[model samples]
Target: MKRLTSILLSLLIVGSSVLGGCKNKNTSEGKTPESSAATSSVAAPTDKEADIVVIGGGGAGMTAALQASQNGAKNVVIVEKMPQTGGNTVYATGGLNASETSVQKKLNVKDSNQSFIDETIAGGKKLNNPELVKTMVEGSAAAVDWINQIGGDLSELGRSGGMSVDRLHRPKGGAAVGPMIVKTLNENIEKENIPVLLNTTAKEIVLNDKNAIAGVKVADASGEYTIKCKAVVLAAGGFGANSDMVVKYAPNLKGFGTTNHKGATGDGIILAEKANAALVDMEKIQTHPTVEPSTSVMYTEGVRGDGGILVNKEGKRFINELETRDVVSAAILEQPEAISFLIFDQAVREKLSAIEKYINLKIIEEAETPEELAKKIGVDPAAFAETMKAYSQAAASGVDKDFGRKEMKSKLDKPKYYAGKCAPAIHHTMGGVKINTVCEVLKADNAAIPGFFAAGEVTGGVHGGNRIGGNAMADIIVFGRIAANSACKYVEANGGYTEPSIVLEEAETPAVPEVKGNFKDGEYTGKGKGNNGDIEVKVTVKDSSIVSIQVTKHSETPGIYENAEKNVINSIIKKQALKVDTVAGATNSSKGIMEAVNNALNQK
Candidate 1:
């Protein structure tokens, strides 16, 4: 089952939205956010002990734990809520972005960190934390070198949206890099003998009277427990899995198919918020263009990198295919049916993979003539032919006059034409819990929560408003290591965990429940959306108590939402109300369940 899940995850991994993560605001260097805590002050403690407790088992969390162990943290553990590690890390399909790496040097490609930084800032619309972006840019080269050292590779390089240079580095085997990186990290974890507790969910950030992190409360199969760790690193990740949160926060992107796995829900974000960590840019989500229309499958950006043009129903080129995902997505969203088609010739079809699958899945249409391809995909046949001709002319002339695209890798003149219906899907969430350069989680007042830190997709202030393609892996790697290095040093200075003489009073706010209403209730039913489709539920109320909640219909992705479904219904029934921290990463499904329950009990 694990093997099958991993295989499916690898195949489904696609584009900047699924793989890319992180975003930010301004800072001269990777300084604390304006709302940062001043010191790493400690107050109370609890029952168990470990040098560090890293939450989530994805790229950031794994890397942070390994780095900490490497730095001599004797007792380090990774507490993951799922049965296995690899959050969005296992869903990555793109290459890492680095400047002036060994691969670039060997290829004689002239690139600089500053150039990378300039493009990233521009891509992020200048809302990025200049400091964090600079850190990632500076650390990018080292990050690539580190990945290589850790049994990974950068054998192939390509260009992605919003970048002028060919800095996107692929894995050694091919475009499939997610599993390789995950395997390498997992192997490292095994070698270090790091303890990983699967199916363990972090319930709360236990703070002492000093308003500082003391320990964490976690729940596992055995029930809830506490682990007294000197430091907690929240590499848990973003909230793409929770449809309700997405709708509430980024309403502009509501109802779009999301590219995140169910576990990609914003667990660490909530944990941080409860811990007094201020979040940044929570509304900015990166929706990648060219996701397979009407499906969650994502077509890799390499299609466009190898010269694929997106044409609308009128068979006309819209925007530069090589622009940032944010720009390309906006352009596609403006088209009819919120869809377009990716047009390419034999040369592109041959070099690019995913062709057979696209064809088999009926996601792409192939024809010997542009007109035929256009007809099949619902485009104006004559206009499509003309568009192809114009594209060919521009390719030959080295200038795209219609869309002002300068990067022309090939012309769409060859025979055996191919086109795929393309649309955008909500991919990466740019907004998240704020963290400083050293990976320290910050409070609402801009102070560093002494024992709290975060990295990977969970921490914000890295990518800004728009994350440049191929930058997510680089961000996680660079900052994950920084977090570990900082955490280990922190453990040493803070000494071993000890029970303090105090009771917890300055903790986080509990999940607030709605006021009980006087409603003549027996049974009610309603429908709401899960991640992709509708979720229907039947609510049973007895004597004003939510006695039972049963899910009637749902098309949510399996494995991802099973736990979420069981959780949301159970919680509402147990609490007899709709106040609960959404099942960590399955917020959308949970919301749908709640909505259904609400629908069922319409205060008759």
Candidate 2:
């Protein structure tokens, strides 16, 4: 893999031809110039150098750096534009997807890597590079081991869309999986003293006269700087946050708010393109079916994966809830009101620990009986009763006459059933800079660009047309490791020097903000983000004390959150404020309740 002078000249000659048909544009435009003084005071660009540079701090970037270090890379640096690390990886609640892991073997879930490969190819509509998909599937179990070795947890397994078996692995904790991965990877990165440049934005990829990666230009608080590196790994994520990119690429999503983090504006796509990397499937954006309509916060597919059902306005089951995200979203959008309800009972609630948080916020609706719940949510009571009866029968017999549902893990018989209104939100961009099996960035003709690589959502061709839920995590972790291993080979073959002064640094976590001000008594609705969805609450106050709390609606777990709801309400009444210990085993729901109450009080 050594870059000889002849190869460099050959690359420089064809680089223009490689980029000729590519498209490029800034993700957004600032409407007007900043005040003239702001422009006049612009700082000069600084300069630095490295052996390897990672351009994001998400799952992919973090894994890339750790693997690179393990592979004996020195002066490996991760430059993140955000103030903190953990890009979209911090927000994913559904967890990683892998087959035949040690946990799965212990849990006795039947799965094979071939089954995983088949499902992935089918889910991606066969447009996936088979080689890339195979690589992901083969490396998945080992990737899980890698995460576990780094002190990260991937304990629980659930089924997500496009998986033929129960294989999505999440932290046993009910909270989002991203936090666990981020926490572990971050601690390891810091423990290893890997230099991380926070608030550093990569502006462009600089190439030497031979057209290989020379370095990268970046901007930060101290102004712009050049990071001369023999190789670059672009893991900066996708463009769901950029309205312009969304419209230009996936125009069908013009009106949908994205579930992507704001920083997911395809900066990596722009930067990689300048180095002759081609983009693919840029229009293939996948929308999640269960996003809370107004807030656009995702309702994790685990609900359905654990046996939740979708019902329309008429209170009847429509599509099989276990279908792929794209299929379910289309079914929902075609429904009356362009919305649907997710219904589950105590059995499902027991399995989904995170639902408790949504329940305490009142975003999930609950009721003592089916009829009562139907009346409360504007669904036809009679129709709902009949639907429940038939559904019960189907669950008992394992024969779904209406929608052809194959799996019926539990029956929805328990009282205080949970339901939430849902609509689709753009969830993932199944497209970005093109890369091959080893994760080397490629040109339009599919030739590797040598010194550049990409992993995660920032690279396309893994999940071809429509991405499945849990596969996103797998894509990043698997390819990220591959990218790192390949980069190590490149770095070892060709040597580079790093500046001693520019070393790794870690950021300290900020303290939580306390709710301020004395209470004014009034009923107000407040929404708070839960483990997997948004929770809204109605808190009533009188005499500067929370007199009562009514959970009129919610989409959280039943039994677990039920206890938390009662416990939190009583605690709020006793304390006359949201300051209270979270109920054990239902901490997320309890926190959501307290935050919602605090938000309600803040309205005063």
Which candidate wins on lDDT? Answer: 2
TM-score of each: 0.74, 0.78
Per-residue alpha-carbon lDDT of model 1 for 1-604, expressed as tens digits? 0111110001011111111111001111222211123334322222456668888888889889888877777477777777556688765666789998999999899999999999999999999999999999999888888888977776677788999998988774334456557767876765665666656689998888887667889875334568777789889989888899889897877778887877888988998898899999898888888788566777777778878889998999889999999999999989987888888888877765434445545666789999898888888899989999999999999998888888888897888998888789888888898888888888778899888889988877788899887898898899999999888777778774333221211111222223353445677777876665678887766666776677888765433455566556655654567655466556777787887777777645
Clashes of each: 23, 10
Alpha carbon lDDT of each predicted model = 0.74, 0.75
Tell me how far the alpha carbon of residue 434 in candidate 2 is from the true structure, in angstroms, after superposition.
Answer: 1.0
Q: Where's the lowest-lDDT run of ten residues in candidate 1?
A: 7-16
Error of 1 at 223 (Å): 0.6
Q: Residue 519 in candidate 2 has what lDDT? A: 64
Query: Could you tell me the lDDT of residue 394 within candidate 1?
Result: 97
Whole-structure CA lDDT of model 1 = 0.74
Residue 68 displacement in candidate 2 (angstroms) = 1.3
